[model samples]
Target chain A: DVKVTQSSRYLVKRTGEKVFLECVQDMDHENMFWYRQDPGLGLRLIYFSYDVKMKEKGDIPEGYSVSREKKERFSLILESASTNQTSMYLCASWTSIRDEQFFGPGTRLTVL
Target chain B: SQQGEEDPQALSIQEGENATMNCSYKTSINNLQWYRQNSGRGLVHLILIRSNEREKHSGRLRVTLDTSKKSSSLLITASRAADTASYFCATEIGSARQLTFGSGTQLTVLP
Candidate 1:
C-alpha cells in the first residue's frame, strides 16, 4: 500500500506569519500535488511538482509556493499567512500505473 | 478551471440501496477517477476509467465515462452505513501530471 504523510495534522498561525506544510510519500511517485479543500470550492490545486526542482502553478497559486528538493518530499509554503488562507490542505502522490492519487490525512490550517 | 463538477451536492439513502452520482467536465481527459473522503480524513481512491473506456467495475462500485460528452457517473450498489462519505471525481488530462478535482457529493447512508 502507498502511504502519503503530512507533517502536521493541524496548525495555527497569526496573520503575516510564514507557514509550511510538509508531505512525504513512501512510494517515490513522480507526481506530487498540494490542494486546499473547502466547502463549495472542492479541491483546488495550489501547486504541483512533477520532478525534483520542477514546479508548476495550479489554478489557485496566489500567496502560496511549493518546494520539491527530493523525490519523496514536497512542501507548501505560505509567504504571508492570512485569515483567508485558513482551510484544509491536502497532499497527494500519483504513479503511472493507476493515475489515481493517494492523499495525505490533510492539515487543517487556521490563520488568525 | 477545467475541473469536474458533480451533480447533487448532497444525497441521503437507506442502507442496502444504491446511490449514483454524476460528474461533468469541460475539456477532454485522459482518465477520470473517483475518490471517497470520510469526514476530516484523506481521500481514498475508488476507481479509475480511462478516456477510451466506457465503464468499469470494482467490487460493488461501477464507473462510466463518456469522453464525447465529458461526463462520468459513479454508482455504489448495496451501500452500507460505512459507505457514507463525500465522493469526488477527478480528471487527469493528457500529459498533465495533476488531476483536477470536482466539488464532491456528500452521501449519507441511513441505517
Candidate 2:
C-alpha cells in the first residue's frame, strides 16, 4: 500500500506568520498535489509538482507556494498566513500506472 | 470552477438500508472516481469507472456511469455505521493529470 505522511496534523499560527507543511510519500509517485478544503467549497487545488524542482499553480494558489526538492517529498509554504488561510490541507501522490491517488492524513491549519 | 456536482448534499439512512448518491459533471471525462473521507481526514479512493465502462462493483458498493448523460451513481448496500462519511465524486477530464472534485455528499448511516 502507498503511504503518504504529512508533517503536522494540526497547526495554529498568528496572522502574517509564515508556515510550512511537509508531505512525504513512501511510493515514488511522479505527481504530488496540495489542496485546501473548506466548508461548501470542497477541495480546491493549490499547487502540484510533476517532478523535482517543477511546480505548477492550481486553481487557488495565491499566498501559497510549493517545493519538490526530492522525489519523495513535497512541501507547501504560506508566505504570509492570514485568517482566511485557515483550512484543512490535503496532500496526495499519484502515478500514471494507477488511477487512484494516495492521500495523507491532512493538516488542519488555523491562522488566527 | 467545479466540474462535478453531487445531488442531495446530505443523506441519512438506517443501518441495513441502501444509500444512493448521484453525481453530474459538466465536461467530457476520461474517468470518474469516488472517494470517502472520514471526519477531519483525507480522502480514500473507493472506486474508479472509466468512460468506456458502464458499471463496477467493490464489496457492497456499486457504481454506475453513463457517458451520454454525463452522470454517475453510487449505491451502498447494507450500510453500517462505519459507512458514515463524506463521499466525493471526481472527474479526470481530457488529458489533465489533476482531478476536479465535487462538494461531496455527507452520508450518515444510523445504527
Candidate 3:
C-alpha cells in the first residue's frame, strides 16, 4: 500500500504568520499536488510538481507556493496566513502507471 | 475553474437502499473519476471511467459515463453505514496530469 504522510494533522496560525505544510510519500511517485478544500468550493488545486524543483500553478494558487526539493517530499507554504486561508489542505502523489493518486491524511489549518 | 458539478448536494438513504449520484461536466475530457472522503480526512479514489468507456463496475460501486451528454453517474448498491461519506467527481482534461474536482455530494446512510 502506498502511504502518504503529512507533517501535521491540525495546525493553527495567526494572521500574518508564515505557515508550512509538509507531505511525504513512500512510493516515490513522480507527481505531487497541493489542494485546499473549502465548503461549497470543493478541492481547488493550489500547485503541482511533476519533478523536483519544478512547480506549476493550478486553479487557485494565489495565496500559496510549493517546493519539491526532494522526490519524496513536497511542501506547501503560506506566505502570510489569513482568515480566508483557513481550510483543509490535502496532499496527493501519483504515478502514470496507476492512473490514481494516493493522498495524505490532510492538514486542517485554522487562521485566526 | 471546476470541470465537474455533482447534483444533489446532499443525500440521505437507509441501509439496503441504493444511492445514486450524478456528475455533469463541460468541455471534453480524457477521463472522469470518482472519490470518497470520510469526515475530516483525505479522499480515497473510488473508480475511474475513461471517455471511451461508458460503464464500469467495481465491487458494489457502478459508474456510467455518457460523453455525448458530458455526464456520469455513480450508483452504490445496498448502502451501509460505513459507506456514508462525501463523494466527488473529478475530470482529467486533455493530457493534463492533474484533475479538476466537483464540489461533491454528501451522502448519509442511516441504519
Model 1, global lDDT: 0.94
Off by over 4 Å in 3: none
Of candidates 3 and 1, the better by TM-score? 3
B52 Cα displacement, candidate 3 (Å): 0.4
Tell me the spans in candidate 1 whose CA falls farther than 4 Å from its real position. Answer: none
Cα lDDT of model 2 by residue, A30-66, tens digit: 9999999998878899999999999999999999999
Q: Report model 1's TM-score to 2 decimal places.
A: 0.97
Candidate 2 ranges beyond 4 A from true positions: none
Summarize candidate 2's per-residue lDDT along B37-107 as a digit string, tens digits.
Answer: 99999999999999999999999999999999999999999999999999999999887799999999999
Q: After TM-score superposition, what is the CA distance of residue B103 in candidate 3 from its true location, in Å?
A: 0.2
Interface RMSD of 2: 0.5
Q: Interface RMSD of the predictions, in order shown?
A: 0.7, 0.5, 0.5
**Where does candidate 1 chain A have its weakest 10-residue lDDT segment?**
A92-101
The global C-alpha lDDT for each of the candidates, from Candidate 1 onward, is 0.94, 0.96, 0.96
- Candidate 2 has a TM-score of 0.99
Structure candidate 3, residue pairs in collision: none
Question: Per-residue lDDT for A43-106 in model 1, tens only?
Answer: 9999998899999999999999999999999999999999999999999998877678999999
- Model-by-model DockQ, in order: 0.90, 0.87, 0.87
